[model samples]
Target: MVLADLGRKLTTALRSLGNSPVINEDVLKKCLMDVQRALLEADVNIKLVKQLTDGVKKQIDLDNIGTGLNKRRVIQTAVYKELCRICDPGVKPWKPTKGRSSVIMFVGLQGSGKTTSCIKLAYHYQKKGWKTAVVCADTFRAGAYDQVKQNCTKARIPFYGSLTEPDPAAIAYDGVEIFKKEKFDIIIVDTSGRHKQEDSLFEEMLQVNNAVEPDNIIFVMDASIGQACESQAKAFKDQVDVGSVIITKLDSHAKGGGALSAIAATQSPIVFIGTGEHIDELEPFETTKFIRKLLNMGDIEGLIDKVNQLKLEDNEDLKKNLQKGRFTLRDMYEQFQNILKMGPFNQIMGMIPGFNDFMNKGHEQESTKRLRKLMCIMDSMSEEELDSPEGHKLFKNNDDGSRRLRRVARGSGSSPKEVFELIDQYQKFAQMVKKMGGMGLFKNGDLSKNMNMQQMNQINGHMAKMMDPRVLQQMGGMDGLKKMMQQFNQSDGSGRPGRGGMGGLGALGGLNFK
Candidate 1:
């Protein structure tokens, strides 16, 4: 079973507790059994699964009969914590400070995505203002140098590899030394991928390790290997000092239960997980957020961090316009751009509460298509029309302005009606933004502060009206909508790691109008 399916099964089992006439021992036992079955089916090691469920059972004491406490919530929370516990090795990985030179070594079996992961890690740090470089020392594999050269060229990160260098250690030492001399913040050394039976490759890894003396050694694990990942990870750990692990091929369909189990076997923390084939698809792994996202509870912290990474140039402009109660078509266009830049459409939707289930397989593709089409329609418009505060009126469906709408549709290869749909969505966003502005929500430039509960509900009510009725229904009506917004606001101000002012735009993106 894939991780998503396992999460669903666990969620369903927990939700069953609410349906029970009484939260008694038998009911709890049934839920535990369901949880155990789900984990086992996901290919989690049998021992780990048993320990997780037993730990959850031990935490819940129905016999204590604490008055006024919701047993269902307690039991569900226990299960959630236990799930997180099994996935977390509680070991903090080494981090390189800015302006300091550091070397990282990559080791993994062939086809484990080790090469791609090295590039992804370099790109990740590069984006964060670090001078990152990659060194390819995989002389065992043909074209290894070319692969690193090609990807690094595309990512604009400096890379060192030689087609003629027969000694991997020489290449590794030279690459690290040169980057260190240039004052690079992070230098990643990509080693030859090897299997347990390949003693020669292991010896080569040890040689490179001694030459570069990497600050951290990352072992990449392919999540598609099912329960065998534990053994494979153990094999790698036994051969070298693996300080951190990165699980690759953990996309939606991957069976990642074994990858999670491998954490225990390797005794190393997972620094990141590859979610897709794209270079930007790697995400830093946080146990609580991962489990929460898996259980369909959403990850506001992750969402905020993603938005912050955008560092949108005109965020101040957007915030000022919202404060002035003026939202233009250009504002909506920029937000659409932010959403697209935030990573995959489904991944963005999954970070918002109540959107995971709504953005399932087919629906995600359709929504992405629709979003892109809307952007295309906007692309065909003039700057005057896009930046105009008149919004939908700029393309009014009347004799005088009808030509403008038709022109946009024709230019975008879309129907006039489709153009109107885009306009309508923009109008809804405008209305929500205007209402929020009127409530002084943006006056202080903080979306999470200085708003009373009444004001929050008022804005939530307005937003609820503008959202797709089906989406609102799936979100559990007005109460659920209110709760979701409150959760977002609370998370925003939790002193967590996220760039401020991004929340203003982040909240706007969450108002998916279908």
Candidate 2:
């Protein structure tokens, strides 16, 4: 299944669980366990995972014992509450100004995608009608100037950087002056990234902050850093008041649990997530949806946002074709085009609950290759053939079907059997589209109602079972295996209906991982 499809399925499952009138402790425990396992597989921090799960468990227990609620309702409430607590707690949302420019400084370790994120952020703000400009103060890196310049060019945003300047503070101060004079609504400062312990780099950041006086300090961290995120967050917080975080390389991280929780522990909200290396791949952070996605509940809001951003409305004919069960090769090709917008197949699928675990196992590269090949074959078809397969002249008066098969095979660069397989796959998908009442599959309410939550839970449960230590080692002793297991267990036990494990450990209040 596609990543969006998997996410849709997970969302459907969670909604089903949420809508349940009764809450069973056993069921809640099992669901929480599944969520825990999913988060662990997503590369979230183990300790943070524990804190999140414990919070949910505590809430569940309180609801069950104090309120005497149903199993499903209690589980839903606990899931919502705990996810919000871990992701945001007391974190405030960023409200963009209408009349004034907002300065946001990007910081991170070297190669953490800070420079790229700056351009992406610029594009994001530009899309919102903000006059955006990028300032490159990364004089420390060898090719930083060229990198930021190239990105600014692609984004069509103004950029200010100098190769000869040794003083980053002077560049920052001048950049702000230039932006102000140009009347730009936003100025994004791309600072030089360094390791957490680089005292000199930290001092430079302080100097830049003093010069720029940015409204928001964004720490860009790699999602794949896993357990090390705690220390990284602490280090950055000590050096500067990091107002928010942007977790990059999310597509590569199988366990993304630590990025948000670690920063949240430091009292910083995650403002954006970098799902891919592309300039437009950054997304605003939403706590509830993110938690649901982690637990394989699916992110309906995310899917809708993607559809809206992709301008799916322009493809009215494709919608009609899908609804009429006439999903021809042309329609299939168009769907592929849309899929590309969501990033790689594996990365997209990772956003869905159960599939995330599989994606982390390095299956994304393989999936991308297969999808590319499939698309290539579909692309070879003529417009006429794609529009009306039965009326095509290529297959006229061919009783034995050999000539027709050979023609399609040659045109699509595939064996006759492979061509037939593609046809069969398309036909099956067409049937599914018809069964789903056509284009209603894109509607949040209808799509959620049609999803099989039981199947999703079963799949997640099976994957979790397969990920058990004995099974994992038997398959192949994976790197970062222990951390993954710990995160999984924590998510699984997150929402049990009663003061579940809350009092066992003291609140992790004011505990700095650095």
Candidate 3:
């Protein structure tokens, strides 16, 4: 079972009790059995599965905590906690010191994606204002140097490697020395891997480690390797002090559950997970957030981080325009840019409860393509059109709507109807932003600030109109939305859902707000 399947199965097992009037030992036993079956099939170790089930049982003390507690929610929460516990190693991963050069080393088996991960990590640090560099010391692989060089060059990151040097240790030492002298804060050394565990491989890894004396040694593991992750991790840990682990290739049909349990066995923190082949696919892993996403529960904090990141990319002008209730085609284009920067759409949607199922239905790519097409249509428009107060007004003026639309369609190679559709979208967006701006609640998307009952109803009504019927039904229509908002308000003490959806971005329906 893949992790997604595992989550579904475990959650399904609890569905039996979700509506049950009474819970007894027999029902608990059955639920545990179902959970055990799912975990075992997901390639999770037998011992770990047994431990998790036992923990859940112990935690759900029926008589001790009685009917006063919602038994259904308690039991489900118990399972959720135990599942998250299995993924956590109960220790913090090593971190690089700011303003100081931190020598880090990457190690893994052949084809485990160590080189790609090195560049990914380097790019991650590079984006965060660190002077990061990569050292390709994997002389054993046939085209390792070229591959690393190619990726680093594409990312515009400084890289050090040698085509003539046969000794990886010497290259690693010299690379580290040069980067240190140049005051690079993060120097990542990509080491060699073997087809399988061997004395020669370990010896080579040991040589590179001794030469560089890295501050952190990260062991990369292929998630698809499943049950073998434990042995491979142990093999590397025996040789070096593996402080962090990065699991790659989990976006396949691999039984990722095993890797989680096995990595836990290695007593190292999982610092990141590779979700795809793209360089931006690598994401810093948070145990609770990861489990929440896996179980189709939202990762609110992660969503906030993504929004914050986009805001840091010079959104002051957009914010100012939104404050003045001025949303134009240019604002729409800016929103398109923000959508792209928010990482994958499916990943973003998965952070909202009930959205993972929506994504799994295959709308992720379709929506992205549509957004891209709309952007292209906007790009073909003239500067006057993009900055125009009303998109439809440009076509509706004395110049004639059809002729103006034809010009745009001709330039963009899109049908006139497609251009009309884009304008229609822009119109709806402008209307919403105008309303938000009128109420003076447009301060950085603080949706609930100074909001009265009528204003809440207005916001809720617009959300209902924009939301798909299916999504509305899942959220229990307006009643459910009210409940969700109430819960959010209670927990956060912010009077309402701050950021609501899209981090603190609030309403992008007008390409407005932060």
**Which one is best on lDDT?**
1
lDDT of each residue in 1-514, candidate 3, tens digit only: 1256776777678887875678878888888899899888878888899989999988988777764788778888898898878877887899999878999999998889999999999998888889999999999989999998899999999999999999999999999999999999999999998634488878888899999999999989888887887877887787899999998887765477768876766799899998777888788888878877776776655655676676533567666767776678887787777777877776776665555566652676666777788888888899989988676688766658888898999999899999987887677667766787788867664443566778767766775666557767766688866655544433322334444422243422322111
lDDT of each: 0.82, 0.63, 0.77
On the 0 to 100 scale, the lDDT of residue 146 in model 2 is: 98
Q: Residue by residue across 1-514, what tens digits does model 2's lDDT show?
A: 2223323333444555665466566656666666666556655566766876787777766343655445565666676676667678477856568678778888898988999999999998898778999999999999999998887897799999898889999999899889988888889999999887789999999999999999989988886677778788889888888888888876655556567557654688888888777787787777776666655544433433444455554566755554453556666666666666655554454443344445542555655565566677766666776786232334344664556667777876789777666565555444444444443433421122233544334323333333335334432343333333223223313232211011100000000000
Top model number, TM-score:
1
Collision pairs in model 1? none
Candidate 1 residue lDDT tens string, 383-437: 9889988668877758746888899989999998888888877787787777777
Clashing pairs in 3: none
Candidates, ranked, lDDT: 1, 3, 2
**TM-score of every candidate relative to the true structure:** 0.94, 0.68, 0.92
lDDT: worst 10-residue window of model 1? 497-506
lDDT of 2 at 321: 55
- Candidate 2 lDDT at 413 equals 78
Total clashing pairs for each candidate: 0, 33, 0
Model 2: worst 10 consecutive residues (lDDT sum): 505-514
